[model samples]
Target: MKNIKVKTLGAVLAVLAIANSHANETAEEQGEGMLFRSLFGDTLERTYGITVSGLLDIGFSRNNRSTSDERDDGLSNLPITGLSDEGLELGSLHLFVDKPLKANAIPRVTPLPGPKPETADFGFTIEALYGRNAQFSRTYGWDMGWDMNEEDNAKAKRDRLSFMSVPNLAATAYLPYGPGFTIMAGVFGPIIGYEIPPNIRLAPNPFASRTYAFVSNLTTVSGVLVGTRIMDGPHGLLGIELGIAQGWSNMRDNNDDKALLGALRWRTPDMNTWIDYEFMVGNQENESTRDIQAPTSRLISADGQLRQQHSLNGWHRFSEHWLLGMELVYGHQDGDGKPTTVDIVTGPGFDGAHWWGANAVVTYQIRPDLSFSVRGEHFSDPDGFTLFPTTTARGDFNAITAGFRYDLNHNVSIRPELRYDWFDAIEHDRPFGNGRDRTQLTATVQALVYF
Candidate 1:
């Protein structure tokens, strides 16, 4: 009887082992998803909100002129200014805090009924940046004409390398008043150019270089902007925006005159194409302001001046691996014996000073981790106003850049680029460096790490 009992138990054990084997086989047939889930969380359902982000960028460049002084001081863009002509440089250290508004719903039917309807939402963002790039991020709109000491302190801080600029210290609200309106107020970039300076988290390429057009156009403003979607469907989305604020690049009102800003944004259905039209018009400088200092240069005026700018930009993706972007811009400023920011020259008055430019960029993704890009641009600043070469007038400038981005991983990338610059001379002169050449060449390598 004891032996019989032992045999039955053995049979039961064998049956259970076989069933376990079948279950393992079934799991394998399901593409090892069960094992994957056991190790990593679901990609689609991973939740994220209220995030903190940062970027660290470093680069080295060799300019053809080989002069560390880099004579083209005011002509180059921020961070890439005169200080970065040679050797290794810290590009930018940017940090961002984003708290986007969450969607909430209200009960459609009150007494034990159906779905809930969402109401208007609100959110805010703050950006803190350091390094050479901080110079361009200054905002003057917060100057309330209250305390002179405080204003001086703020100005001093802005000049330092550890500059604190709340570039995006703004509030946003989504009001269902009309066809879904969005109102934003604070300091924001002027929506007039295609080459947007990248914050820490949004750098699209490995190399952190910019076109000449971006360096010359409008940069930032402080004020209120209202926008609404005109059309949104499978075909695409169209939007129009209007804004009023302090004149270009001023945190404080240089004058009582206000600037007007407008934009039209459109995106294709598949989200591969975009077109933008933007403009700004108003008095830019107030020389009569009592607290402000007198104009020290021809580009800055003590007298109030009027300026208007317009830009049209378009971007299209031909495939998963190829893309193209283009921009056209025209701007005019009434120079009142003072040089405008766009053109800082010392000479006769600039009553009808005008500037225009065009830019195009092409990108090809060689692989998921490697990509290449080329950018071409041309800008014209007539009257020897903006593109004033050293002791000469070089009204027209052209540049071309080629670069490649290689991603080390999700958090790190390396970029190498080469650039060539040429000029159309109204007067024979060298504008790029202390060297006596109408053209310049440069090479750079950069690394970006994100957290």
Candidate 2:
């Protein structure tokens, strides 16, 4: 408790100091400073050329099929972190700051230059977050002040008051070699996925809630990433990134092995259409299973085993008011049967499991302040590798969602959504309600305020 208080105080002090760093600069001289002030607080000004923004999200949801507890919400087949089936929930509160890059900050070299281009500038971003969504975004090794000797359950430990979390704390530096080649280090999310992370650039959220594949396969990566543009043109653009990280959903290195991360991002000529290809190879372990492994259990290899994942996401705008988004993801984990004891380290008997899924969303803008969207998805977890296991076998889940966004004003918006999920019964009986139901329905409404 003392440490938490100290940390909180330190954070508050840091915010104040950073917020006041540019006290001497006027809005005109600050450039991007004025833009941020207009959106954030009236006093919110750029400090050292860094801009600041924030968001607050609150939501209410109910699951019609949940019978476990009337008061407690249930989200069958959905990511456990976003669960809010039967009550109001504080989704997240986020504050982010980033230094704007300047065109002439770093020198750029061209093979045959008609005119030498200006240098690239250095930039960095830091995001401080709180609430249930923040907790769900926690990376491994981030201590929640839990007593390991008394309890090892991740969920149970999180039930305490450790709600604050830092999901993005990265710094970026551009190189002088070529056109703005840059390296980013620290805790940052992957450059994949169609769903926008909460509290990012001011944009309309495509949906009021999240999807299973979004939470299960797409998580944050910790380490360093190097990125540079392959082609930059008014008609089209291409970029590539490569990096090495601790591992999936991990904040600290758990072993000697490091994960490989790579991505390719492309945008069409108009910049309204874009696509991304992302891949990762590494090792991951379910801390719960490994903690209780008996010494006599067959010696498992260091870092456990191999886990690989791939994803492709794209989006396009058909007109001023209509747009579409799509995503495809596949993930696999290797767990040889010989090491029976270590097989369930990540999940129930998922020694060798694979999962694949696809989802599509369509959005229609009725007016400048009103919009609607619909999403449908299907995922297959053969051997229950990527999803919460029920009955230790392969299972399939299908889900559909519909939602609409109504902007109350420039700084506030309201969203309401309905979702349905169902699972296969042949592979395993009821997967929800303590294995009592095969389908679930849910409804949710949320509000977002930007600053």
**Top candidate, metric lDDT:** 2
Best-matching candidate per TM-score: 2
lDDT of 1: 0.59
Question: 139-233, model 1: which lDDT tens digit per residue?
Answer: 55552222421334334323322234556667766676555666778876654677655534343332456755565556667788887666667
Candidate 1 Cα misplacement greater than 4 A, ranges: 1-48, 68-83, 101-118, 141-162, 199-207, 289-304, 336-344, 384-393
Candidate 2, superposed: residue stretches over 4 Å from native: 1-47, 68-70, 73-85, 103-117, 143-162, 199-205, 286-304, 345-351, 389-393
Collision count for each candidate, in order: 7, 4
Residue 73 error for model 1, in Å?
11
Question: Which pairs of residues clash in candidate 2, taking residues 3 or more apart in a chain or in different chains?
Answer: 62-85, 106-119, 106-120, 235-269
Candidate 2 per-residue C-alpha lDDT over 75-116 given as tens digits, one digit per residue, 9 for 90 to 100: 332332353435655566677787744432211111121222
Candidate 2 has its poorest 10 consecutive residues by lDDT at 104-113
